[model samples]
Target: MNQPHQPSRRILLKSAAATTAALAVGTAAAPALAAPGDTATAAAAPGGFPDYRYVKTLLKPSQLTYNPTGEIIFPCIRGTAGRLSAPLGRYYLYYAPHDAPGGICLAYGDHIEGPFTEYPRNPLVANVWQPHYSVSHVSSPHVMWNESAKEMWLYFHGENTTTRLARSKDGITFTYDKVVLSTSMLPAGTTETSYARVFPYELPSKNAHFVMLFMLNNTTNHRDIHWGWSADGRNWTFDQKALVSHNDVSAVNIGGPHLLTRGGSAFVVYNKDKTSGGDLMITEVGADFTLRRHLGRFYESAAGAPDNGRSASPSFGTEGGVPYMVYESGERLQGSISVARG
Candidate 1:
């Protein structure tokens, strides 16, 4: 992800009663920040889970068949092909180059370890949607399949302040939905809201079927993680507070949150910019929107890894039950898609 114009830029709760109350109204005030040198209430947990071992560069900007000039960053994978339209392939790899005119692009392969082909026309979605709206660029593509609607849900952002949604039955042609998230929903000092990922989760309310986690840039110019809840996957409501902050992990900035469930407990796997080679960190969230503990670094690149001593923006997947992570490996704004498995 790029430096937010020099500006800015999830898990279950443990308390059942608190979770129920928060879910009922679709909002929860984040717990107060801990004092300096403290990480909420507990020490950093040791070791990362799924223990990602470096794989290979899945896609590089220079390797793209079309518009291969810029960097390629965020990666989201869906196992099944589109239901209402012809299959693009058995698997769809959604990614985008986080540069000006950052286009939401697509590529496909028969296997997770892809000898993938980019969409011939390229840039499935662009910054300008004509009559709807326009911006300098649009990037950070995260995709999910809506089973009931039989459509693909694409979430992305532009101009930093807004995160928009679009739906496509064919997974190729999309119709603009709405701006599901913006900085206005967050606290007063929030400057930007972007990099959102939506997942199906069991919240306590009957109307809510999904949860969203994203980055929030504050007045201090430090980035933190914030979240929202959704009913029917289209409409959303947010918490006025942050889910995780730079102070929570003693980092200058923190972002890129992906939900990971292990042993029936939910944890958020994210990256923090405290080191030159940014390390992926994990934290446990409770039933009341309370951040429980700061899990320590899981994956930090060695001196010569393809991540080039830098890694950020991770999305997880499994091939035959073997877990893996696809992440931005290279320099921050200028990166390539690299993979790792354990």
Candidate 2:
């Protein structure tokens, strides 16, 4: 958000299958340079669902509520690269703020359109080295309400080298449950790990399942966003490994995936950093959970960020019976909670 100062650091597992659960504070990876002159257009299809209009800015430097913790926004997620997970009556928006150096916190929002509340004992998470995980930046959140499991599942890519998970009955105030799937959880042939995302594909399921898709950073510019499946949302088994790749050469840092279903087909939305800014790209997934078509670019960031992911989709059942997106915007303005609707 601030003039991207480099982290002197870059970390990921030996392979992409290894992952870590992020939502802590202070931890970060060395900012990589944007792939030059990329992202003029989407390579696959395009993210063309509906036009996303700005709803409101939730947290910002000038508008933040000050509390005793430090600065009012002091206890926010540093990465702001987060997502919105709404069940029915409850809404939880995760924030990645740099509470301090090398720390990341999981901030929460009750209402999608909000004067969102920052969790009281924020920085609800941190990355501690475990044999199962590799230490690194624990940020970039994607949350979901697992109806079948009757539990709230939080997923994010952290320093551990892959996207990891922890479960909670209540969305906020979570307990570190366990990593959903990693090299350890896989059968074989998939051990490479790194920080990535795994969001639920919003298709009404009879199979009692969930789908997670996040970037599998195999290389600096050669990362791929892959998918996985789960029966209980606790233990996930691998599905299609590589879902999308850099078919988009005009863009870079292009992976914060959001999946929503319409007409029995699921639409996947992601972002492409065009250096000038970021644009939301969309694709479709069939009932079988295989990649379908790239719709078009849905929305574009004003200042445009190549670092963070702008990956939020529309919830038709949200208040007002309209649709809205809880995504990170104002990245050029130090990032904050923002809502977008068609």
Candidate 3:
């Protein structure tokens, strides 16, 4: 397989610096316009929000058994594992295995922090021609159990340009459903759509129950998180306004959205491109689903750790009343998965 393009260190640093400068200014003020239909009247808490720090490395690329030779695979650099807790105190982790035979793979463990065992039948979803008739090089699997559908739903992107959906009775095997959102669904000038986070959210006013936060890539190549709502897990209606944008956070690029709710309040966590390093930033989600306030950086690369330079692609879950985050760190392909808690 051909090597995926890697940005030079100089370019990466320059981009990070630009993002830092923009963040310095962008986050200083509140957004002038609220998301359409947002009716939030409450101000954000003045401080004392839960701050998360890196705990330890969870899984590295070398640990995946997809490659018999144990070589680090391309595109499988940083992990995007969608974690789910099952009965009997077991857990399932679904992720794209960026090996020679690239596809989505699964791992099982008895604990959240685990010596996870890769499923014997790996590559649960293969890099085959998709329903859209494009050669599929898929990654970034975000799995959720849709109580409404009574089955597991796997949302993923292929080639980092199209977002598609699939369903499974069990978490391991899946069947393609349809393209929920993609560039073709966007306005004429838009370039791509990817990195989707779908979760069950109760919209008290609209009487809806599901929300999607996804990255939108414009013609200029800037990425931002946009909001969408669904009554069921399938069909959706997107708001043109972004939940988080370059103007709001001084980020040239932003994506990797994850939502966590605790004690009747919701929090949105996402990655922002930065000069020091790309890190996760968070904000409160109001009852109306509009982002309430910027809570600043949620997690950054540890000072001298293997992931010290960059971190991105955050996934959140709770087990035993403890909140845990799984994310990718370091450069793509060389990056690994790390977990943290509040």
Candidate 4:
């Protein structure tokens, strides 16, 4: 494993201060901030989840990945959390670096606020689907630890068209499993099914253990959010319903569905392309994973800056009851990953 070069405390403080100032004035209403001596808990945002304050950047683009030569890679997207290994006392982050020979990668850190060290044997999930799909691209990973199965279950897409599965006892080494869901599982007219979030949770009234929210593309190139359920993490049955359609929201494009559970309620955070740029929106999902209550836009791009291009591809995780988000923002093709707390 190659450890990240740590920066000095003074450098970190100066960078954080600049980022905080930009966030404070970027939006019309500044998010609630934690007090001077309060490094443990973030203040809650009104009409949002409690004790959720927007913290500064966690992993900037320059920190995403590195080549064999130790050169920094850019344009990393959809970094998702698996589980906090109680035994190891570390958190696992699986992300997709949208570069050549693309595949899923892994990073681990002692804390969510991290100088996360990248696993040297990265591309943990390699681009082995080339012969089958004719394209080696593999990205958009969503991973979660399944307690009942005693393994970390990873859900990701290949060539941005189908969803697949992999499992690992330890978060590092993974064995490829079958394709759990794909366009074949969607309705007759659907074109593709990709970019999914899979996790284990009991419904308010049912004992079903697995839930998935994925993207369903149509003939017109419009992408809608759909969901599915599974008795186990491997087998899935599509609900054949659109959770968020293009017409349902202001944005023309809607993708990147991430589920955050807090206080016994489940919230879905997704990305949308607004007229100005892009926005990250949230909605409350019913315990059954059917009913949705839109929570409006949570983060938007800053005007005339690198971020003004767009803000999309969000992943959520919490540490010690404090919530954090890692999402892609900046000029679309040249975008980078940024972290915020709430």
C-alpha root-mean-square deviation, each candidate: 10.2, 13.2, 12.3, 9.2
- Give the worst 10-residue stretch by lDDT in candidate 1: 1-10
Instruction: Look at candidate 4 and tell me the lDDT of residue 175.
Output: 79
Q: Go through the candidates in order and give each one's C-alpha lDDT.
A: 0.71, 0.46, 0.61, 0.59
Model 2: lDDT to the true structure: 0.46
Candidate number that wins on TM-score, 1 or 3? 1
In candidate 2, residue 113 scores what lDDT? Answer: 56
Kindly list the per-residue Cα lDDT of model 3 for residues 176-228, writing each as its tens digit: 89888877666666776877878888886666788888889888878888878
Candidate 4: minimum summed lDDT over ten consecutive residues — where? 1-10
TM-score, one value per model: 0.83, 0.64, 0.76, 0.75
lDDT of 4 by residue, 1-342 (tens): 001122211111123564454333221111223333334332333224433223444444455454422211122222223333342325555666555556677766656556566667777877775434435667777776666776777777776668788888776677778788878788787887877887666763444677888888878788888888888878877788798776777667788776666445667777776552476677777666666778776565555433554667666554433345566656554565555555
Clashes of each: 5, 45, 5, 4
Best by TM-score: 1
User: What would you estimate as the lDDT of candidate 3?
Assistant: 0.61
Angstrom error at residue 56, model 2: 1.9
TM-score leaderboard ranking: 1, 3, 4, 2
Q: Who is ahead in TM-score, 1 or 2?
A: 1
